[model samples]
Target: MTTTSTDLDAEALDLLRALTGRADAVFHDGQLEAIRALVDDRRRALVVQRTGWGKSAVYFIATLLIRRRGAGPTLLVSPLLALMRDQVAAAARAGVRAAAVNSANAHEWGDVQRQIAQGQVDVLLVSPERLNNPRFRDEQMPELMRTMGMLVVDEAHCISDWGHDFRPDYRRLAELIRTLPGEIPVLATTATANERVVADVEEQLGSGTPVLTIRGSLARASLRLGVLTLPTSRERLGWLLSHLVSLPGSGIIYTLTVSAADDTARLLREAGHEVAAYSGRTDPEEREVLEQRLKTNDLKALVATSALGMGFDKPDLGFVVHLGAPSSPVAYYQQIGRAGRATDNADVLLLPGREDADIWQYFATASMPSESRAKAVLAELSGTPLSTPALEARVDLKRTPLELMLKVLDVDGAVQKVQGGWVSTGLAWRYDRERYERIAAARVAEQDSMLRYESATTCRMQLLQADLDDPAAAPCGRCDICAGVWYPTDVASEAAGRATTALDRVGVEVEPRAQWPAGADRAGVSLTGKIPPEERVESGRALARLTDLGWGTTLREVFAAGSPDAPLSRGLLDGCVRVLKEWPWAERPTAVVAMPSTSHPELVSSLAEALSSVGRLTLLPPLTATGPGSTTGRARGGANSVYRLADVWQAFEVSPSLAEALAGQSGPVLLVDDLVDSRWSLTVAGRALRRAGAPAVLPFALALVG
Candidate 1:
């Protein structure tokens, strides 16, 4: 019972009226009519939509129309197997015969082929990987495509390497679609895209075919964006737990790495929070577990990498937290859109820090190749498939960097992933390994540029929007810096009263002296206290003196103590800054101790060599106890225990305030101990110092002071 265009138009109107309660509602917009004309004129077409837009409706409505006229069927090629299944389920609920081909069953491919050949399946859904099967082309796919009225490519941005979700299999799709008769009317759609992705889709699929660009402005007015920079990830985790405790509803926490996602989930679970995690590495069973849990609201929050956000929509989400920076603006928008779907007033929190920039640089260097390197890899594999070993040998590069180069090539459509190997995509691009390295380096340089943009000191939002070509965007007044902007105020009365306090805080310059300035009273001052003998009081004084001198670099070193190893440990360094910032002013020492690692001949020699290249203040490993006379345990049976103190000092580098307490006292040696059993070693050491007419000797326990 074949029919014509007029018959299809009638059936489409009826189907629309059934869905929306009005017959004429189907074609009221020119968009639908324009899509129909592609089939009417026998031309392939490309359709792109922004997120929250109804691009799916365009194809589904047209499918109803064409099916009524007895067109064979419409087939949807999707990249996400889970999403494909979900879509099929939705179509079936609407009484449409839709089924998806998936890897879940060994017989799915054969079953799909049988169903398609017998005309039992009205709408067939398959992933791009499935399309690469030889059976798809060797059989009657050409006939099936000709009979089909529309060939839909969902989430079309997957074809673009510049897109957040780049799929290598999508590059082969252009060849597959071209094999179909009259080049089946192709409709590709997604919720997100920049100019680059949109162009890639048209060039790859429609190939100059009519492109209907239906742009939608679906900005949710109730959403608020905020950013917080913290000193450590642990502190950020604490803040996250606090946010979750107060906010009710489902939330998504986006992490940059798999370890972060797993660790966050475990940490949240230990805190009595129900959380699920998703990533590319999740096993099939685990993915099923999480998917079911998420759908039923059994999980209150989901900590996931970007891999989880494609088609899982749970409209009740309350917020999105970016634990790391997204790769690009498109990615950021898509991840954040997961929230506020079924609720109003959704909020997004971005926690940015210096660490994120460095992490991104690491990724940029490791994951992507220089453009020239990518080109060179493609050149080596030109005209034939090559195993990884052969490719590596031909490229003459190490396995890891070479593998990464191939991946970047796959993303760029210059190569294709075949079974157990890869082959050039016949794109005619050529380059050597050197060129690829150069290109990869250039890409990293671009990422550095983006880091600079994020750290800009002014107009963050304006700069971001302008980069995206959205200049009309207004300043988000709720941002941290914007909220703190100040205006003139009538505070002359209050200002006069605080002049002395301000002056005291700024301090005064004086010649090096032993005591505080004459007028600077020590009443209520906590800084001047007795100091310990063995403790390095000069190191603490040097730290304070450096701070007084406004040397920002010394703040991290003097207060923050690290083992000679792990110099970049942010926890230890920031903790050091915390101690110095809290030091009381009256405790200032004129002659500070310089216990710089230089005091140790062995350690200083290594440090000197490293400093020649890395600059001063090299963090080195602890000096292990060895040699016949080396002290490993408590000094002199624990009395005035320098061993325990030295160990703690070596590991944590904490300088007890007891050192500062004993400052400026010209007397016998003073000692600080956590515990002591005997007085022999302390008496002997004290006597030896006094025999030499040293300053007075005293002993104090850190535990007692603590």
Candidate 2:
């Protein structure tokens, strides 16, 4: 039921009619009820709903009610210029008086300010970055605030320090809200929020403000979730190209890094697809242009980091693909949510591989420290007057960890900057100790949360929905697990499984008979230039040897010729069947999997050296396996390349019971094997170790043989 302006009581309806139109100013029943409650009862309402669920519309419609009843303008604070412009445009189309203060033009801001002063603007949208401007708060908004009836914060989750797109200036909004007039109602809206985020929003909005925690259901009935696991990053890109962006409707391809976004978009463009790249580093004007292109369907797909969507409304998105895993599930959820808003049959693809986690870990290690190191650093900095940069240099903490520590300090008011350096803002001793302990505790808790989410046994969607207080939550039947892992398989499932097995079978059966193409058998098989296999197979061999090493490694055949059809194709099963029926190496499944282990250790080391020569692969430490059941196998060659796990057991020469005792450790076991003879064997061993109580097992395939 819609409660248009005409539905109000005679007095209110008459006033609304007089101010606007004669008829049909209806509002959604749900929206109107919430609006009335917010205005009459004075609540800090957080309207949590998915995109295209009319969350903003509800708040805007309520603005009219408040305007009819009160004497001030509604101030909408956002952090995206594109969103501000869109909102202003939306208001104009709806025949509402709205203006935005943004960077589209310096001249426009002056006109907006003038409109605010004249009490003619019903809605005002400004970026939070604008709030930092003195003229906005001190001169412009002061007049509007006196006449402001309500404060609406859109995409309010951005204010949360824990939010994926946290803006530091949002912290100042509380003071801005307080400066407004006459018990002004505060309305906040967001498409996504976890429990911690909700609490942060409440805290930011000021205390004792009644918050309407409306957690909409997580199920997007139109969205189909799929997962694709590729053996290499190059293979992953190929999969994305043929599956995700090939579709007709507007889509978003999310990559983990800026370089990935650039490369992915470049590849798509090369393939003659209309695509654009967006990341944090993208210029504001360029970002706006790309976003507008996406909205209008002028661009078919956008390869971007998570910085593209946020408050910008692009409801026509047909699908979203994560070309790589994001830093956290929070980020993944936010990025994927950009799709499937108003469209039917929207698809989301999560490209799977352990490499994603490894990349994330590398970034994590670069920014964060080991638990003991974090503790040591915090303790060293405890009660010490040091600026963030000074502390970073002292403790060797990277930017992210340093920023996180500073935020924690600011939140607790434990440290303050006085001129150049930092100083304890409180009674230095107890405060410093407590803040240090608290930050440590929070860090531990966060780590636990990350682990829990990573290895959660429940339905992923339910777990995500449960993080929010979505009361009507159930398994999203579209997710990987719900669609198969925890439920009976459908025809699609049987077909997909058979397709995978067939592809594997074909690769193994034909690989031996099939020869490497042209000069592919050599050290460096180049479409452009030739180089020695020894130099090309291994890192640091010498780029001078192979000037044009096509973006493929010579050491392994993980993605060999005639790979399965692209991820989205239903015909992959048929394609696999055809390959199995014809390919020469179709009979060599074990050899196909074993090919990487066959490459000489020097080759790998050389490759590693070559990459490192230019600085790529960083070898950490080689963990050796020692157990009663461990035996020494012959090295594939003179180098430390081909020693086997079974061989390691023979060398240890202990009984199975003793081996179990030693290998069944409670923490992560980094098993050193000269060669991973079979991924299947490693899989079995890993499962055994895990079942025997090892938390996790990391297999390091070292090449000891030349």
Candidate 3:
């Protein structure tokens, strides 16, 4: 039976005081009413309020009130590990016992499970992926679904494919919600959802019951918004250096990619500012330390990708500067919302880059799973469970994309991740082609919105507010548009030069393939386990990664569609010479050989000739393409190790003349190629050269695409 005004208002106030550590404290607008909706009416609710608006308070208070009446613990499906950490800490302050299970605390899982079973934890915080854990799903979830007092879905916007950040695992919540007991209240919360996203999330939360949505103004009055259009990374870095100290308390510097974040952090550290890179590549343990460092103002800033966004909270974070704009205005709002939650003023600036769209396009395409790929994955599944690697051997998709597709399929009931691996559920599924097309079109629209945000002069804050469909979308008089560029607009020449020099210094080490991909034997390739050192290429070098801050622009142009394959540019040749000069190889090359490259034969041959001429080494005849599908020296669209290796196996061979030449030489052979994607081509080519009697092979490339 519903509580229906059980009369806990005084106790709720006492709990709020205990939470705030103030003798006299009260609830924010709609907070008390939302609490009543949960504790009294036991209804599903969604609270969309700005960051620091105390959304957590409503749930925490509701949980406490409900528990006082002898209810089970609240299960929170949070989005990030940092969020789990923060939630656990906040629960402690409110005197509510909390426990979290995430990738960072795997060792404590048994303890957490035990505590949950013993009813020692009042609230449980978990990543959305935790819902799909085989053991938990089979053993613990059924019981939790029955007994859970309340369910809280934080960052609920992620549940909607229409949201800027759509998470497949979060889709699993629909099943959980559909199965949950009707009496148990549900709460969904997000600060970043626009109207469409809100409607989607609201529908999901309702399941069958009606959902109560409480939306507050999305505006952050304290943020002074601005955009600075920079032509190059060097100038952007220069601007950051000139103004970082002048900005408010320690904050986050956002970048679009992991390499960009790392590159920015390196340059900043070299400039003597205390900063560190935080991205998806960062270790979970290390990420915790970095989050604390930022909260405590121990570092000037953390250069980060979107991984560091969401649930991270520092009441006094005084600034958020984007090195490049996010693909969507909503995502940008969520990121910048991390700053100025408690303070009266904060600075929010955007440094738009020419490379932003390219990066955006890459992510946009990569995130969408194709219907053909889905069909391929389903065809490979069987009644028997198959681990991801075992499944990869039979499919052409890469590991990441494959796993993502499986997650989507899992939510759709086509497959399930069991204890051993994934198994087909024999459930009929249809690809929602029209829905996906709609989502794709929405993504394009959002991208265009970001473009407008960059160039808009009509109050940046108001524009973001309007994008989120906030009722309070009035203009702020402090934006760059309204105030005539309040922040620094010029970069220091010295700082720009330093950044340029650092980024210009190129040559990333390309580690050789250590092992053949699994399923190679099935593909008619005998390679397995570790590649023998005798047939392996020595550690190689590339002029730059296509994503790097330096030479990447030039490399992108050279590989872009419609770009002609020509001889190495003068700048590329000079870069090659510099890379070789500092390569620190074990031995100098005695011979230079070019890899077969129909698409870039001129580029490869010119690079090989340049290296040979500069080092005064013998220029042997280039390798020849052979075997089926070998007419094109480039790979045959291989997406995984097994497939890539099969395409390249026996694809390149040394001629009788070249074999004889290699047999007589003792020093390492410098093998040149235009690009390296899967590294299988280089590995196969190097093995052939080694078998033909080259002592060692040194693989070099103009760019590394993977």
RMSD of each: 17.8, 16.3, 1.8
Residues 438-529, model 2: lDDT tens digits: 53454344444544555555566666566555666687777666675421212233334433332222211100111122322121222223
TM per candidate comes to 0.59, 0.58, 0.97
**What lDDT does candidate 2 reach at residue 443?**
39
**Shift in Å, residue 408, candidate 1:** 7.4
Please tell me which predicted candidate would have the highest TM-score against the true structure: 3
Better of 1 and 2 by TM-score: 1
Lowest summed-lDDT stretch of 10 residues in model 3? 629-638
Clashing pairs in 3: none
**Which digits, one per residue and each the tens of the lDDT, describe model 1 over residues 1-706?**
6557687567656655565555566553445664565456555555544343445556666665556556777888887756765677656654467877667654777777687778777778878766654455446466666677678888777776555543556766776666666645667777666566667677777665556655434344445556666554545566666556555566788887675676667667766788977888898668867866876778887889877777666666777888767756556666777776656566677765434554454455444445555665777787677787666545424465676566556645677767657887787544446744654654454455455445656544444444333425456564434454221212233333332222122211211112221111122222222323432111111111211112212222322335242232343233323433444434321111111222123332332233223322222222221231122222222112222222222222213332443343453232222222222223323333333333443322111110
lDDT of 3 at 23: 86
Alpha-carbon shift of residue 367 in model 1 (angstroms):
5.0
Q: What is the lDDT of residue 380 in candidate 1?
A: 74
User: Weakest 10 consecutive residues, lDDT, candidate 2?
Assistant: 539-548
lDDT of 3 by residue, 1-706 (tens): 3343535787788899999999888888989989988888889999999999999988999899988888999999999889888999999999999998777777888898789878897898988898888877787777677668999999999899887775899988977888777889999999998899899988888986899899999888889999999898889989998889999988999999888898889998999999999999999889999999999999999999999989998989999999989999999999999999989999999999898898888788676778888888888886578999999998877788888899999999999999889888989989988888898899899999999999996989899999999988888888999888989898998888988888798898989999887788988898679999899999999998888877887898898867898888899999989999999999998999998876777888999998899889999999998865333324534377787777778788799999999998989999999888778888889999999999999999999884
